[model samples]
Target: MLKVNKLNKSFGENKVLNDISFELKSGEIGVLLGKSGTGKTTILRCINGLEEFDRGEITVDDISIKNVKDINKIRNKTGMVFQNFNLFPHMSVLENIIQAPISVAKISKEEAVNTAKKLLKLVDLEDKINSYPFELSGGQKQRVAIARACALTPKVLCFDEPTSALDAESIKKVINIINELKNKKIAILIITHDIGFANEIGDKIINI
Candidate 1:
């Protein structure tokens, strides 16, 4: 459902992504694996419209990212889970998950809350519905972030260094949650340096 061809990016004189190319089909998990400076996260940012690439093409379900006017359209089809779980610290878990659905999807508050509850259950955080970010552990926060991403019902989900801050057990839980997403037919792209974790969840790995 997503394709990147001849992708290139730079910061001033420094080139970060060089001729990177890959494709991710529905229900498939793609991993961008490399060292810290390999531009893995840059690729995700480019796909998500958070960064402008100097050259190449990225299409999500045939909608081109190059069309600036349709950036929101592209984003609606793609969900991103950041390296740092970017949850609103003051909002409860349920609120965090429902915000995008209500604001972006234009769903009613009651419906969004119902969807959020289901997502929370999926992430094993149903009991944390009223919990704040500060009250949760790193893994719980990440799971909340995942639920928030899924709230948009995106076709493609991009995770940036998902397991970077988790312990072994927590990493396992996160990986399991990611694995379950494949059944939902969401194309998953994970950018990480953790080879073991990547091998466990990635159907295909793009080395930058």
Candidate 2:
């Protein structure tokens, strides 16, 4: 689903990503494993068009990232989950989940709420939709964040240190959701330091 050709990026005198090249097929879960500061997150950012690379090309399902005329396109097709949940604090759980789809995706509020409720159920957060982010636990918030991402129904998902800040139980819950995504044949790219989680969900591991 993605073809990255001769990707290279540098900053001043430092080169973060050096001639990095790879291809990810549809429905494949690819993992990038490396210690901190090895450019794993940078690679993810570049692929998402949040960071600009000096050279190379990224094509997703035949659409080049360069061809993107706006940020909304990149976001709609490629969803990202961060280590920190990045939830909108001012909004309620349901609003957080429905805002992007209703605003950016231009869907109706009723439709987005309907979709959000279904996603909350999928992530086992049906009862928590009425709560605020501060009212939920870290794990619950992350699960809600995942549900928010799924609200967009992207073709591919990118996770950056998804479970790094979670507790053991929370990690397990998040990983389970990720594994379910793998089973459902959603293209996923995970950047993690956890060896076991990498082994469990990654169909291919690229060490940076």
Candidate 3:
């Protein structure tokens, strides 16, 4: 459901991603494994429309990132979970998850809340619904971020260093959650330095 072909990007004279190509299909987990500064995260940024590439084509579902007049069109088809779990510090967990759906998707507050509840339950954070980002642990925050991303019902999901700050147990939880998402047929792309984690969950591992 996601394709990146001949992708090339550079900052001034320094090239980051060069001719990178990959395809991630529905229900498949594709891992981008590399050391720091290997453009793994850059790839994610390009796919999500956060960074414009110098050359290449990126399409999520059927929407091309470059051709879309509105970037939100491509964004709506993809979900991104950042390494730092970029939750709104001021909003409660339930509010954070429901924000995108109600604001961008134009769903009613009641509908958004219902969807958020189901997502929180999926992430095993139902009881933390009223909690703020500061009140939660690192793992809990990440789970909330995941729920917020899924609230949009994206066709593809991108994760940047999902297991970065978590402990072994938390890593396992994330693995399980990602596995469950795969069953839901959401094309998954994970940018991780953890080779072991990648090997365990990735259907196709790409080294950059």
Assess the local accuracy of residue 167 in candidate 1 as a C-alpha lDDT between 0 and 100.
96
Question: lDDT score, residue 55, model 2?
Answer: 79
Count the clashes in each prediction.
0, 0, 0
Instruction: Provide TM-scores for the models.
Output: 0.96, 0.92, 0.96
lDDT of 3 at 78: 88
Best prediction by lDDT:
3
lDDT of 1 by residue, 1-208 (tens): 8999888888999999888889999999998888788788888888888888888878898877654445776888999999998999989999999888898789999999999999998899999999999999999999999999999888899999998899998998888888889988899999988888888899998888
Task: Give all candidates' CA lDDT scores.
Answer: 0.89, 0.82, 0.90
Instruction: Tell how far residue 76 is off in model 3, in angstroms.
Output: 0.2
RMSD of each: 1.2, 1.8, 1.3
Over 35-149, each residue of candidate 3 has an lDDT whose tens digit, in order, gives 8898998888888778878877888788766532356768888899999989999999999999989888899999999999999888999999999999999999999999998
lDDT: the better of candidates 2 and 3: 3
- Ten residues in a row with the worst lDDT in model 1? 64-73
TM-score of model 3 (CA atoms): 0.96
lDDT tens digits by residue: candidate 2, 51-150: 7788777777777754324444455777778778889999999999999998889999999999999888878899998899999988898898888878
